[model samples]
Target: MDLGIIGQAAGLFAVTNIDDILILALFFARGAGHPGSTRRIVLGQYLGFTAILAVAVAAAFGATFLPESAVPYLGLLPLALGLKAARQAWKSHRNGAGDQEDTRAEPGGGPGALEVAAVTFANGGDNIGVYVPVFATAGIGGMTAYAVVFLVLVAVWCFAGRFFATRPVVARALARWGHVLLPLVLIGIGLLILVEGGAFGL
Candidate 1:
């Protein structure tokens, strides 16, 4: 309800504010790499990011149509998500989870919107966690902003992915570190929220 106050304080701008989508865009691009070498995978990265953000925007809008209870609970998201990412990354490190290259995204080599979408949808393994609750507070303005930022970030990541595939070892190293780094960073941020909420006796 207090969108203005919240937005200003949070520096929220709609679609752009969704850090998860942006991260997905970046990682997908980093791993996706080499459009010339692998067009389908690169394109798939793009469409996948777009679809997830679109769903997130819709969910954020839906929050408005539904209930005010949605607003307060938004605080838990970044922390919970961040922690989850950390756990997943830790697991992936142990089990080689992030190591799997998508067969569809690879796709014998071609690029099109539909192909992109399919690859994207395929990469959409954890769709719900990415789209839901966060968007629950997104209004129309937020959604549009989210979309624009998300798209721009995706474009940048895709470009990077396509451009830089020569150093496979380095890229993979960064990718592995990213899995651990991003989540911990996000989790720390979430913990900050708890601090501000006075949940702990200061």
Candidate 2:
């Protein structure tokens, strides 16, 4: 195992995924009233990130067989997701719900693992852009090392997010500001991905 590759992968994942901490923290705070929310969040994050990793691996291996140029256009996925989030937030505001997250509660009907996974995937679609290039260049050994480290770091991220939400100040702020910030963050991520991927010459 190359410690260099492992260290690099860990750092990259941690840096690129800092926004995930905020999202997870919101989830933790919102779901605090619901039992098993933490478990669902953990499972959902893993499922979502695994999908991203699978796509990276596929793109890496299929680089020769596929059009590499099309990879950048994959930014559309996040762009669409961000738009959808904005629409939802708008609808929530129009409906006078004030906060979408607060409006989603139900007795034993909180967001499921799949719901969280979907949000995770949408939020992290840009990971494909970053991961695919790294994976393609890393070869199988380095890819494996990156994957192991990334997954471990993901668990650590989840724990940290949950911990952050436990703070009274953070929890109150998230509750007050998270709905508005979430959509804007998603849109910003989409634009960043597009620019980084050189999509449409951006």
Candidate 3:
């Protein structure tokens, strides 16, 4: 209930998650006409975020017991995902109709919650790193307070993303470049995480 906790949590969530808005906006634009798309995206975001928080919680509690050397290797998760995405993007670019084909086929009737969750988790490697340190410093009460604020802010983020997706200029730009940029962004994040964590000493 401390105002300081709320402020810190809100600020961290907002600042650290700015990129999420663009990604979520792309999702919203892609699923524009699909029924239940909004619900699925929001649910998937929550699930993915919950997974990140779980990892953060575990690391914070067992920081001393866990091997710091292995932490940086976790970047591989996003790196592998980025490679897969790059392959897909390349294929889509090679085949004139490939992107359209992908658009028509939803993993489960329209970007099911699981698929979105996978992407969210893959994109959240940095979130886990940043959150672990914060959680490690906070007590149980403070952690709980931060969690509440974070969850609430997540909804706000989703709304903002959806709003952005509805804008004509934003929608067009995302539709055109999202596929290509997302993969590169993921790759960059992975490398950044590895370097920051001193993985491979680089």
Candidate 4:
């Protein structure tokens, strides 16, 4: 089942997801004020995400359980996060913050590898759910494939997140109202999580 690896990877993926979220936020900040690069963001996405996931997978190796009970609650997090994102994007548009909104938005050109790492570390909230307890339990044999699933998932998401952030259509949509949708989806999942929390938490 590769459960062990999967558990570990899950935690790492969660953290990476959080980094991407922050990257998106910065994308807007730069677009309106500074102007970050696609390469730097992508590189950064990989950095913070890779490190966290690595540790998580390793942890899953000889442990028992990673608190699968939190899965439901974790599931809801995405929806809430997405919705909130959309709302903010919409508000930015309404306010006509304009590309030249704030000097603070000034992007630090060339998001070099180190910069990427810094950004990844800076955005950890997004991974709070699946990241922490993903493999907190016990029982596991060979977990190579399990970890791969999560590693791949997070890696892909980070790539896409950065790519999308730099896209004109995506940026415009986000500026218009994408954050709202993201958060609402999270809300729905949150409700489901609540149910899980009440019923079979495991």
Can you tell me which runs of candidate 1 are displaced by over 4 Å? 1-42, 63-116, 125-127, 168-202
lDDT (0 to 1) per candidate: 0.48, 0.76, 0.77, 0.50
Per-residue CA lDDT of model 1 for 1-202, tens digit only, reads: 3545345423432333344344343344334433443454556666766665665555555533323333223335556666766676566567654454433245442234443454344333234344555556555665455556556665655555544433467456555565565566556645654554444432
Q: Which segments of candidate 4 are over 4 A away from where they belong?
A: 1-65, 75-100, 103-142, 145-153, 164-171, 196-202
Please provide, for model 3 over 25-77, each residue's C-alpha lDDT reduced to its tens digit, 9 standing for 90 to 100: 86776667577888999999889888777777888887543355766666666
Please write out the lDDT profile of model 2 over residues 13-85, one tens digit for every residue. 9877898998788667656767678899899889989887887788888744335576555556556655875
Which of candidates 3 and 4 reaches a greater TM-score? 3
Alpha-carbon TM-score of each model against the true structure:
0.38, 0.73, 0.78, 0.42
Native-to-model Cα distance after best TM-score fit, residue 61 in candidate 1, in Å: 3.7
lDDT minimum window of 10 residues, candidate 2 = 103-112
Candidate 1, TM-score vs. the true structure? 0.38
lDDT head-to-head 1 vs 3, winner? 3
Model 2: lDDT equals: 0.76
What TM-score should be assigned to candidate 2? 0.73
TM-score of model 4 relative to the true fold? 0.42
Residue-by-residue lDDT tens digits, candidate 4, 1-202: 5565667656655655653554544443233433556555556556755665554555445442335454344444444444555565566667775532543355664234554454343333234334435544433433345445755775666556656766787777665554454445345545655575563444
Q: Which scores higher on lDDT, 1 or 2?
A: 2
Arranged by lDDT, best first: 3, 2, 4, 1
